[model samples]
Target: MSKAKKVIFVIVEGPTDEDALSSVLKQIFSSAEVHFHVIHGDITTEDAITANNAKSYVAKRIAAEMKKYAYKESDILQIVHLIDTDGAFIPDNLVKTRTEKGIQYFEDHIETGEVKYIQERNQKKSSVVASLCSTGKMKSSIPYSIYYFSRNMEHVLHNVATELTDDQKVELADAFADRYEENPMDFVAFIESEEVAVPGGYTQTWTFIREGTNSLNRHSNLRILFEQENLKSTD
Candidate 1:
């Protein structure tokens, strides 16, 4: 008899994130089942204003999807939320600096020491993570994990792009076209390397991705879920 495939649900902001994560997770888990659900498209602007709104939005959507599939919470092995920081800061928060490139924003947490650039227009008074954590709804949801991009997905890609030369850029572009088919492991290694300079928080974004799997264990929320579900790489 064959073992059952564990179901993992991922909720993201947009299609790009869905695509990117689908590719990455395909490389990470060989036998488990993974699904991506996008929320921003179906949600109203008013429903997305605060962290509670975002959580409610995601919760409703998750419930609907679950019903559509006739699957209960027990059927899912894990639920992951991925969102962008978007440069939202508290009032009178002056822990940022302006440079020729852009505005560098820093987190108040001394241990994190994260810094990332936020374009003036992209900066806001509230962030997605802040809102989600505000009501403690998402955090309290068991078997759930949350990950964030510093500014946005493009910003994360920019960090990787800046580290490569023209030739390397071309090679990377080609690799992406094929979804890094030739050497996905090397691509993963390059992104997680300390040599890659991801400003605005050192390796904050990379650390989020590399958690668990023995590379970096800074935040192991996702890692713990993977282990609990017994997800493993075919390679």
Candidate 2:
């Protein structure tokens, strides 16, 4: 058997994100080695990371990972980042208020005791997402693309809108991965279906999601990658 030609590094926010999608992606991109790196946190909303520096921060993270493995630029085929669109694109007026000192995310609006904080977060995160998705290449000179599960991974994949405990997340993720590991094409078909799959090409799809409550809904543009890769193969 031929070895995969290059590395397809995938950065995800949590272990469950990896567990839910890695096997399916690996099967799809069989020509390249798919490696998942769980960040355990959202890079777009990290401390001191604004839209202005988000691109550079991501480049740095990728560089650090590459250096850790001593993988040169030539070894990397591309970078695929998977993130959750927690309705950050919505306007500040949509950020509702609550008495509790915590944040609650819903499909249409976010409820938080600190409304101003949430607005600030949305501003920063939205900008970061916009910057990263502006083009198909990162500042590191490597091919890059990002996809999101609205609300969150669990909301999209498992159909559970409410937040899940860590234990519940692990269980659902394992079950999801197991279901698709045998027939990744089935998972592909599901991902490409009209229900959750947003219509349009790469850049166009991003624009569609930024409108109104769409970002909070269960939508994905992941099928664009498959179409792009298929075109590459034919070329």
Candidate 3:
């Protein structure tokens, strides 16, 4: 008998984000055999951002958790995207330095699979957008203000509770189109793409060049490793 095929683990920022992406991916890859695992780090921002030591500790812990699910070289599609909101006392130089270190670390640990790091300067609002679009809404029901719209959405979803059906939820999403006049799916994709592009932005606009360098090195290693594997299968 053959071993059951392993699913690709696609880690995201948080549980809600995981759920949102999971829903989409499940629909898109329903017929495909790969499974997507979203890991929400157990540590809080306060614990992960206190100092260099804290950050390292959190990263190591997260890495250990991931190691538990490591698959055969040919079976795992390791894709991890971390969205960070640790903006307090963010110095320009710190971000750069961290990026460099992150890159170097990945270069050293390429065997561990691919990992994506996204340190968003403005993740709060971006996350709100991602979460809201996950809900299906109507055109007229969406509020005008992005802030107000998101808050109102939370309120409605909470009120509806289990009564919300997939079709009904999508109907609510129509309201977002009317209110923002932008495609809901497009909005979700836009925010997700932004989260993925955080490393590049760090190089161009961030302060800590060394950190940025580290992150880049790490990102490059992972990007290449995972994509190469994926290409082999697809090609």
Query: What C-alpha lDDT do the candidate models reach, one value each?
Result: 0.47, 0.83, 0.32
Off by over 4 Å in 2: 1-4, 230-235
lDDT by residue (tens digit), candidate 1, 11-129: 87766556555766655664656778876542312333554466666677788987777666656666777655433332233334433443333333111122332222223324434
Q: Per lDDT, what order, best first?
A: 2, 1, 3
Among all windows of ten consecutive residues in candidate 2, which has the lowest summed lDDT? 226-235
Candidate 3 per-residue lDDT over residues 1-235, each given as its tens digit:
2225433444344444443345544443333333444445423243234323433443454356446655433443333333322221222333333323322112112111112222342232233323332322212221111111111121222222122445665565444334333343453343334222222332222222123223222111111222233323521
Better of 1 and 3 by TM-score: 1
What does candidate 2's lDDT look like per residue over 74-150, in tens digits?
67777889889888888899999999888887878889999998899888888899989985776546789998888
Model 1 TM-score (2 dp): 0.56
Instruction: By TM-score, rank the candidates, best first.
Output: 2, 1, 3
Q: Which candidate has the highest lDDT of all?
A: 2
TM-score of each: 0.56, 0.92, 0.33
Candidate 1 Cα outliers beyond 4 Å, as residue runs = 1-3, 41-49, 52-54, 90-128, 131-142, 160-182, 195-235
Error of 1 at 9 (Å): 1.1
- Error (Å) of candidate 3 at residue 231 is 7.0
